[model samples]
Target chain A: MPIDEALLERMLLRESVSEFLYREADLLDERRYTEWLDMLAEDYQYSVPLRMNVAFGETDAREETRAGREICWFDEGKETMSLRVDQLNTGLHWAEEPVSRISHLVTNIRLDAVELPEVAVSCRFLVYRNRVADETDFLVGRRKDRLRQVGDSWHVVRRELLLDQSVLLAKNLSIFV
Target chain B: MTTVEEPTRTGAPQVRNLVDVKNGEISREIFIDEQIFKNELENLFPRAWLFVGHATQVPEPGDFFSSWMGADPVLLTRDDKGELNVLLNSCRHRGMRVCRYDEGNTLQFTCPYHAWSYSIDGSLVDTPGALHGVPQQKAAYGTNLEREKWGLVRAAQVHNYKGLVFANWDPEAPSFDEYVGDFHWWLDNLADAFDGTEGGTEAFRGVHKWRIRSNWKFVSENFLGDTYHGASTHASVEAVGIGPGGKGKRRHGERQNEGGFSKGRMKTSFRRGHGASDNLAYEIPYPEFEEAELDEYFVAAWEKRKEKLQAEGRLLGGRGPATLFPNMSFAAGFPRTILVAHPISPTETEVWRWYLVDKSAPEKVRDWLRHYYMRYAGPAGMTEQDDMENWDYATEASRGVVARRYPYNYQQGLGQETASDLDGSVHSHHAIAGEVNARAFYRRWAEFVDNLSWPELTELARVDDRATERDAVVTDVAEGVKVLDAVDVVDGPPAQ
Candidate 1:
């Protein structure tokens, strides 16, 4: 069935938001955290919930139930994210001293219109990082982003990352993805 | 010299007596030998109350996490009734891992190969194939299968002291308090430093796990001492102005004298292999917080801790990077707790790093602590990477025929341990550059690995009863418990 004009506009808006996310990923990959932070709303909520199989043959994974109640890999607010970035820039963060070069590949973008007038965009990401004299550490996951339009630019208000591996291989999440 | 006789294959040579450990320096064979490592898994890890994941990890009902004790896979879970359980990860039917993931919240664990299901409490729930063909499916693989017996082999003894959960495989081993000995005070000090205040100590989210190739003992020894290396191998770090400076023959001396350069403090070693070092330096030393105001609670905690130390006839020493025997270590200055447990192989050890923060502190403080922890200790941390590089190189080097033959030296301060009257604490003049802590650690290591029975080991430890008594007093003070007015000189406390 052919979609309506309004529906098409919403889809386009969602796609644009998804594109902005890719740009954000690019900024992070380029170690441009300050630029990436600009894409986030002041009250942004970023979280990477620790994934688990609750029961056999169960699907329709609920984000809140999985993340809020259980363990989360990364649960941070804007202030925390800022602090992390600040630490990275300090040059004394021994963890990031020999900084790992990262490349973030985001793809398979999908958008869902929610009741709150905010678009929920889901995309898969592969963040590859290589530290000095060490093998590459790969982090492959899906990011569910809730983006809202504020003035002329779209801002990411919420993000819930779902990683494929239960045990993270990276020594640390010193870098933002 | 009496020749040590080898025992028959059936009878394991009567494991070395603990009292005999004073024969000069211990040979490096103890760290590298496969047989010794195997015995350790069976004896030490099993008998000792090894630290496991915190209760916070499996807070909710149905939450589960997998951990290991020397190589034994354990599934730590919270049942539907909200009770904590540590069970063997192996499936009872086919011996496959029931829970494969490192951590998760789940109602039941179903084996991937077979459709056999077990509850979060490790009760066998259902077997699809069995019900179809066999009339007595319940009898074969059902709840009647002595759920407790078949569910999962629970750690023989599981106990928690201040949010830290530890498990033991030996039923006869002393209580966790006794096992902890004077070290309990150090743990209490760590908790008290951040706890009892408004928010208490909140375990910052996320755990960093990595592999270091050196013998686990080597890593423990490094944390224990080897402060000598900071000025040399890490000179590049100093060149970049990240670590301590003052290069020359008197580099350590210069740093120690110039308080600005040396920002950390090492503590006197206690009986039962517990000691701590504190780095007043940044937990996540970045320019971001250079001008930021300090938290009142953090400063107060330090003051209170120092006061307590002073009252106990001990100096209000510097910050602590505290270590409890066998595996656990904590950096009180950063309020970071690290537990590195040895796994199956001597060459392979898993490191679990926790960024412990004052729970009462503002969300921003917790955030900073997390960031700092990630920056310094996490897999991505520069110092951690450097340490891993050295560990990997050491492990590789140890495997070589020539390197294996060469004695790995630990003779940095062979005879320079000076006795101090202050709380009977032994002080090394060159604290950073000395091997006193390492030597002390190895001395305790040999005592533990000598394979004496628990009671026998305790008896041998009493040889320096005064040190043990001092340790107990400090521990009491650290734990915030009423200091015992008198010492009861007895073993096992008359069995209840």
Candidate 2:
């Protein structure tokens, strides 16, 4: 059976979102904060939940309980993002001071329909960061992004990055993926 | 007539005199030397009350999370009976990690290597291949090993105060309250400020783990004493108007132009290594929001705390910034807590920060606090990023042959430290510069590194003459506060 027009449109949206993500990665890797900032909505929300070892066979990968859900790290809004970008631009931001060359490879894009209009998009991503003075540290994770079509462009309303490793090898998370 | 015993161990030096504290700058050997590292793993780590995860991490009966103490993996789980248990993550048969994942809810943990299963309580439930292969079946493997004795080793002591869990390997260490000492007051203030009506606040998942190349002490000292670097190192933040503006512009309520503000801030250090710089009254300056907007929250919390203090017949007008000895530290009123844990070598440390908000607070308050915290303190936080860069460089620089030759100079305010106006608090005139807080930390470090028994260490600390000047200031301040209180009643509560 041929794909429906609505399905085709959805696929196009997915592709566009994926392309935008790659472009965003490129902007960050190339140190283009201005361009990167332009891509974000003024009220965009970004968060990376701390991954923990949950019991086997449980479907709820992210635990948000009062006691067990500790925030390992996160960025809440655009103002924070501006501060971070500004720090990076200056000779400050010691974590990334020397600046690590980063390559974010995003692949295996899969779209699952949870409900109409709000699709769950999952992609495999491997981020390699090479600090100028230290050994390279790599992070591989699955990005579960909630993309919404706001007019012509797709904006990331919510994103959950689930990293495979619980004990991270990187010294500090000064970079964003 | 006294006889001195000669040191038998080749690398082990004789116990030096307490007066030798002057020479006790942390040696790079503590970070790099394999022997010293081993000694620390055996001696320091196993003895101290190492922080584990918060109780919230394992909320439900079956909920569990895995963590590490040095190299030893441990599983923190809530059992079938809902009791929190910290168990070694090793299997009985071949010593494999029972649960490999970081956290989850489960009835039991099964070893993948040999299929040995264990209940959440660390009781061996089944040995898959034992009954069929062994002639004695249950006798050979199951019934022979006492399930209680053979199960995972529980931490020596696991306790929590206000949802924060800590475990110590030493059974004889001071009680949690005693170990916390004056730091307990800071924790109380923090817990009291929490807006959560349902007992305590929750940590959002997503730990940003990264390594820095410097000694663990460097990280601790940096956080403990280096507020001086904030304006200079984070100039970018100022340029972007995220943090304090450069030169004379005060970003927060902090009076950047006044020398006394910095000095008054530095003088606030608690006994037992807990200390905070700037904001002597444990209040984090709020430059982001207008005073009118913040007054409701701050005044309400402060008024409640003041009433509690008054009922207890204590002074509430001033209590300095907060710090917990060894690892944990916080700016309480700001509602941010940093828990720093040493994971591997002394040079390697893991920093975890929680943006604490009152549980009963409005969603907007929580959201705003989360936003502010992330902007300044989180892994991607501008200020934190600036600090991390310096940390990474400090670590890298320490590894250099020439740089290692010189001892890190923490003598910024050395002899000039003033005592707190209250008991068990120390102060410095300049909060921005490194001062008594750093000295206090190093003094405690010398005590720990010298391997003094707990009682002996406490005794020696009490008699140590270096703190006399600070102590005098504390006594005078306490007395002065008392006089101020008496006059406050007569003055009819001054102008608001």
Candidate 3:
């Protein structure tokens, strides 16, 4: 078969990107918060919009609360995200004192756009948290991210998530999802 | 004590027996019993003025915000004449919910099931939410269906206290003013701007809502002057320091006075069942922000507020992490917000939280407050996440067969109730660490659940026994000398 150079380069890019995501999931699940934080760029932006049961045609625009102008489950940058990590490290944080067993299942990754040094990705995340004597919660959501290539690694520049819930079924979003 | 069968005997004797407020021992049954839950639904919720939504949520005509009053789904709608109405969301024809969207603007709600439309349009009906159109009225009903009688069941009374909206199902329910009493001061702080401007605040766009497997009362009691839990429950967040002052500062970012954070902190408990954790005398200025712009904004606002409130001879200290009886809880400072615990079952509650901000605040100031609110108050909030863990586990732990035999102790500040300056209210001398508010709250809950008449409830609150005892008792905190000689406050043999 005749080898196509362009197709080969694309396949290699896919492999590296998939590896980067799987590694990120491992870092989070392993409770290596600092390492996970490193994977995020200094200008990293994060948000989880509050889902609403809007009318049919309104879904495309009004289903989720606006990010900057309106309230969201979370709306912050690296500074606040760092504080969350700091809270977890304290061991005094009662919500996660016992250190819940958490598993972040990141899959169905697709590259929506690929620029020179950046790529836009869309994926699904299912975070399973089991803590202290049978307490369990499953957080399922869609996560969209913009990844920036830095040397041999990728840094998450922005992440927007939409949890598949109108009223959050989980008691608390204590663990990172 | 015999537990009566609740089906036919859902009255005062059973409820009164469960709540021993004088002795400060409340049976666990009140928290978990199915009969008590049903009693609350039938007797308490229907008669009490439960919080609906803010006026700003539906400012424009035809705007409707779907909310809940106890078990009933309500639509808070603004009419063409700029009037607000709280209407039952269920359609009269087939009991189908006419409005399913969380919020939207519409001239009328048309039932998906039967096409029976209720016009919110002023031109169609004299009142908004009146039955304006019925599908094939001439053919299907043949003039038998009474459109006048079938208008959505409107709330008997709906009051817009500044921007906070409240609704009552029973006509006999006390007016919102009488029900709130001196507690209105706390609400004034919540509804007004940081600078004491009347009704100068509005809620942010989204409301944080979620379900928790804990009795709704647990949520209520926590906010009802349960300041004792702060040290232990929120220890981690305090250490993390997400407050405006940044790292190593308290969550509230107190400016640091001589006596510390709890310097003059006291529990203000009203016989009307409302409670506030912070006393009016203890004036703690808003936090000193690490960010210069935030500091400048708050300091200027605080100064202006002090000048305004002081000129009016009002106390500059209505900053409350307070609870308006039945379900509404709020705080007016730092992260100003409202929380209402909607009871789902004996062991489940759906909590809705609305954040308030100054309407005239700069974009930067608003954004700062918004971010601060999200990280501090809700289920995803660092400070509040710990609360959920504790509440869920506590409810679970208390549900065991063996656990139900005991009663939860409410004897923290038994007889330390000092006479208050306000009407129908008392302040616990122990202040920072007291269950006085919780005791009064449960006592009022029992009275309401027992189906006490409006006049009877008013009379009982009008003559608070705690205030009358203020004369005789000389409180020795170390000794636990109670107000009543008959009711010993501690576990030891007696207060010798």
Q: Which candidate is the best by lDDT?
A: 3
TM-score of chain B of 1: 0.75
Q: Write the per-residue lDDT of candidate 2 for residues B99-217, one digit (tens) a residue.
A: 87767777777677766556664233432111112234375667665544455667778887777777877788877876666556556655554321223455545444555565666
Q: List the residue pairs that clash in candidate 3.
A: none
Error of 1 at B50 (Å): 0.9
Question: How do the candidates score on chain B by TM-score?
Answer: 0.75, 0.79, 0.93
User: What is the per-residue lDDT of model 3 for residues B1-496, given as tens digits with 9 covering 90 to 100?
Assistant: 2253354343434687778888889888888888789989989999998999999999899999999999999999999999899999999988999998999889999999988899887788977888999878999889799888898889999999999999999998888998898889999999999877899999999999999999999888888888778877887788788888877677776665522233445568999888887767667678877789888888888899999988888886766688899999988887788999999999999999999999989999999899989888898898889888888888888888888888898898788777777888777666455788989999999899889888899999997788785572433321222332234321110000
Question: Highest DockQ: which candidate?
Answer: 3
Question: What C-alpha lDDT values do all the predictions have?
Answer: 0.56, 0.58, 0.84
Candidate 1 structure quality by residue, lDDT tens digits, B252-308: 112333231232232345445554432211121211123244445455655665565
- What is the full ranking by TM-score, best candidate first? 3, 2, 1
Q: Which ten residues in a row are the worst by lDDT in model 1 chain B?
A: B487-496
DockQ comparisons of all candidates to the true complex: 0.12, 0.41, 0.86
lDDT of 1 at B461: 54
TM-score winner: 3
Candidate that beats the other on DockQ, 1 or 3, i.e. the better one? 3
